[model samples]
Target chain A: MSTSTEKEMWVTKLRKGWQKNLPVEKLLPDTQPAYVASWIYLFGVATLASLGLIIATGLWLSFEGASWYHGSNVGHFVNSLHFWSVQFFFVFMVVHLWGKFWMAAWRGRRMLTWITGALAFVGSIATAFTGYLVQSNFDSQWISYEAKDGFNSVGIGSRFTVTNFGQMLLLHVAFLPVIIGIITLIHVLLVRAKGVVPPIDAFNKELGERK
Target chain B: MGIFDHFMNLRAVYIHLGWFQISITNLIVVLGMLVLFGLALFLPFPGNKKKGQK
Candidate 1:
């Protein structure tokens, strides 16, 4: 029953609310706290860089088709890049997770940030699993046969059949990537919004060492 | 024509201990990450000294 003018006002209100919550300065800060100068902060960026390479190589593979990579020399090279990128991605991501956990990065009411980052990690793992299934090789066939029992035991095999090459490929290249990308975006946004957590000593001193 | 030709075609080396076994490549990569993480934790990062000076 709302009028057109009232509906338009709601859009304006939404826009203003969004900007208020995430202003440009906070979203893209030029300067960070001096504690961020530590080498520990590099792992997060390293993880991000590996993810970028992964997406680039994955996109190229998708363009050429999954089966094409099996026989072509250039395709093999690109496929190798894709595989190595996953290795690097997992290495950096696990290190980043360790760094954040040691620092208790969820402090200062940043639980959502921690949750989103963890979700991104889990989603990335599933995406990588599907990538293995779609490799279109004897290894993939062996993996699929091995994994099918586990999926079937969980009663999700019919919906997400590991034996279905088409389903696994689409999940690897399209579905899970989108989910992981969204979760990663939210994680980054939350980090920017909340600012990096302070060092333990600094935080303890600020709180009068109550704990 | 790829730069990693030699690296890619190397023989797969494995270490076996009783029933446990792991490829040398995986062992090296894991060990390398551990070393890198250790270095990152202890190494002095540049630019922190001048952080608040100006």
Candidate 2:
């Protein structure tokens, strides 16, 4: 339905948009400001690494059945790795969140970055909660049984009943992880587009660090 | 909070009054962080208070 020139023009326009918003130099920066050299910035990378570990280990656990995790030693090791990564992911994410909050990292119209990061944190928590429910053990049973009442009290028991193992497993293995991945990618892209926020002192003398 | 096993051991503030059963642990941690962050932006640097007093 479109002419060739018009189609090419649209493609060129999109390319220009990407270049202006997130040039390759900023997208893959070789250097950052000196002020970024602190323990806080490191937590972001650590958190991301922990997330990667969790997903990698989760894939293995999902592939092998109950016999492998409980029967085979390697499966047990991988299962442990996944569990520990979930713990570390939360730990690192919270530390990073605290650091950013202290720095007001959302300054200079970076609110979307902050918002996406917060949403991803929440999605990760939901994913972890489902992971515990999908364990297929006594612990899972107890948690799932206990969780039913809470869901019913809130009147969403019918749609998202944790007592249903099949539904929970499907959601844990697929749906939630996809949501978390997409949101995290958006958060990272927003950070790249916005660049890191400068310190308050760098902005003004009197306003100083108050900002 | 005791109903949720993992959270049971977390030393969370719990309230059970009639139909309302809530744990303030999550609330406190989230709000506490925000409050501390807000305070950091103002205090330890002679900033503003009640306008007439400052």
Best by DockQ: 1
- The deviation in Å at residue A189 for candidate 1 is 0.6
Give the interface RMSD of each candidate.
2.1, 11.1
lDDT of 2 at A194: 92
Worst 10 residues of 1 chain A by lDDT: A1-10
Residues A1-211 of candidate 2 have per-residue lDDT tens digits of: 3467555577778888999999999999976665554556667888899999999998888889644687777887898898878876877788789889888999999999999999999999889999899888888999999999999998889799899998988999889999999999999999988988998578586565454
Q: Score residue A203 of candidate 2 by CA lDDT.
A: 58
TM-scores for all candidates: the values are 0.89, 0.75
Candidate 2: pairs in clash: none
User: How accurate locally is residue B48 in candidate 2, as Cα lDDT from 0 to 100?
Assistant: 25
Q: Which stretches of candidate 1 lie over 4 Å from their true place?
A: A1-10, B1-11, B49-54
* Model 1: per-residue Cα lDDT over A72-154, one tens digit each: 99998899899899999999988889889999999889999999999999889899999999998888999999999999998
Pick by lDDT: which candidate is best?
A: 1
Report how far off residue B25 is in candidate 2 (Å): 17
Off by over 4 Å in 2: A1-10, A205-211, B1-54
Q: Which residue pairs show collisions in model 1?
A: none
